[model samples]
Target: MKQFLIFVKKECLHIWRDRRTLVILIGMPIVQIILYGFALTNEVKNSRIAVFDQSKDDATRLITDRIAASRYFNLEKNLNSYKQIGESFREGIVRMVVVFPINFQDDLLHTNHAQIQLIADASDPNTANTLANYASAIVNDYQNALNNDQKLPYNIDVQLRMLYNPELKGAYNFVPGVMALVLMLICAMMTSISIVKEKEMGTMEVILVSPLKPFRIVLAKTVPYLLVSLLNIISILLLSVYALDVPIKGSIFLLMAESTLFTITSLSLGILISNFSRTQQSAMFTSMMSLFLPTLLFSGFLFPIENMPKALQIISNIVPAKWYYIIVKAVMIKGLGITAIWKETLILMGMTLLLLGISIRNFKIRLA
Candidate 1:
């Protein structure tokens, strides 16, 4: 116990002295959240539009006024000719062209139905969809104003209920994901590198041959990293809740408990890697290439799992961080409980057990 405490103290001293590690461990998440919130968003505003009104009548004028007032579309160009619409789209200043057909008001008065062509640049599908919807809504509003006396049967209005994230906030999506990545980097990769450093410095040999038990030495090496990882998690949680106002709809204690599980699992894997690695560089490179890349790419952090090919998705299922990410997302965003995340919990537990068994066996083999 004394020996473990001594080793933990040494590890703390090392962390306290290193300013670069401190900044990355603490400051990175805050910067990332701000960037994600301000820079990445789905809420379209001030979308550039080109209007080609051939009608030049009261109805067309009224509809154009509504579009301008709607705030969704910015009237960047009042085209002299319909030919300009095609040129504008090609130039990329305009996303959509609102073409009011010639004699639109006359047609509306006689045939009781008028149509305006909505041409959108489908290069960016999501933007095009939003642009088309906004245009349709404007036209609908104008038509409804003209014919408010008629009431349709079975008005089925489906109000959107964005569960978890009401605003569909991108920050909420990325925050938990970043937390998972950071924890894995700190707990697993850092611990492995730290142990490998001792070996590279010829200090691990002394520690290994010392009176301290192998398990106690391993425990000591992990203790400091465990503290650092937990501290990093705390910083992230505080920043996310207070700074970003991203809520923890589920149990905070449960989140911490899951974090602890994930941390220990990662640390154990680190120990396994460090035992075999001859140098810190090798350990760092191996963890980065093997664990970090896959965790970042395949864990559904930046990419959607549904969009990934079935084979990649199946392979991703085996990655421990993928399970951890799902657990964090469910707890933080969905506010789900044990009943909701039993499957993920089981998967994470399974990964932890597999890593733990391998680590223990490998450690024994080294001692022999």
Candidate 2:
């Protein structure tokens, strides 16, 4: 126990002295949350919209007024012809071009319908769709205003339930991903490289030759990383809950326990990588390209799994971060119980076991 304490103290001292680790561990999350939370928002607001009102009627004017009044769109330029639309888009002047056909008011009065051309830039498909929806909603509201007294056939209304994220807050999604990524980087990557560095620097060899057992050495190395990762978890949680106003409807105790479990899994993964790579650089690179990249890309962070190609969806299944993301989202956002996330919990545990097993086997073989 005393020896373990001494080893842990040494690890802490090393981490404290390393400015690079401190910057990455502490600095990365701050930058990610502030920049990403504000920048990559799902809320569609102040999008540029170009109006080409050919009808020039009161109804067209009213519709334009409605769009301009809504905070979702900013009224930009009044385009004269379709030819200018391409140029406007090239200049990044507008996200959408709304063109009212020549007889928009007449068509609506007689046929109870009118054609309004909407040309949207699909570069950012989600934003483009949101802009189109804003226009459609404005038109629908205008139609309702014109025919408020008229009785409709069948009333079809859409009841939207954003299962995990009801409010569709971008932070809800980004927070967990950031947590996972930060832990993986700070926990797995740092520990793996640090262990490999010890090996290369002859410290690990000296330790192995000493009375301390290999398992004890491994435990000492991993325990510090586990603590560091948990600290990061706390930082992320506090930022998400108090700073960002994201909720933690589930038990804080449960969230911490699962996070510790996840950290253990990541620590084991770091140990496994350290065993494989002969150098710290290789371990760091492997952890990033092989671990972090997949976690960020395939863990439903940037894109939804449902929308991904079938082959990619199958690939995503193997990613431990995806399973952990589901678990964290369930526990934190959805406020689900243990039963709800037990499968995910079991999968993460199983992955930890598998990685540790492979690492131990490889480590023993190397010794032999």
lDDT of each: 0.82, 0.84
Tell me the lDDT of model 1 at 78: 83
Off-target runs (Cα >4 Å) in candidate 1 are: 41-46, 56-75, 153-160, 364-368
Best-performing candidate as measured by lDDT: 2
Model 1 scores a TM of 0.86
Error of 2 at 158 (Å): 3.8
Which 10 successive residues of model 1 have the least lDDT summed? 359-368
Q: Which candidate is the best by TM-score?
A: 2
Task: Provide TM-scores for the models.
Answer: 0.86, 0.91
For candidate 2, lDDT tens digit of each residue in 1-368? 88877888888889889978777877787788766676877788999989998999999999999999998999998999888999999999999999999988899888877898889999999889999998999988888788884657897766567776676678888888887777777778888898888878877766777666677777788887787777778778888888777899887888888888778878888888888888888998999988899998888877789998899999998888888888788889989889999988898899888887776666632332
Clashing pairs in 2: none
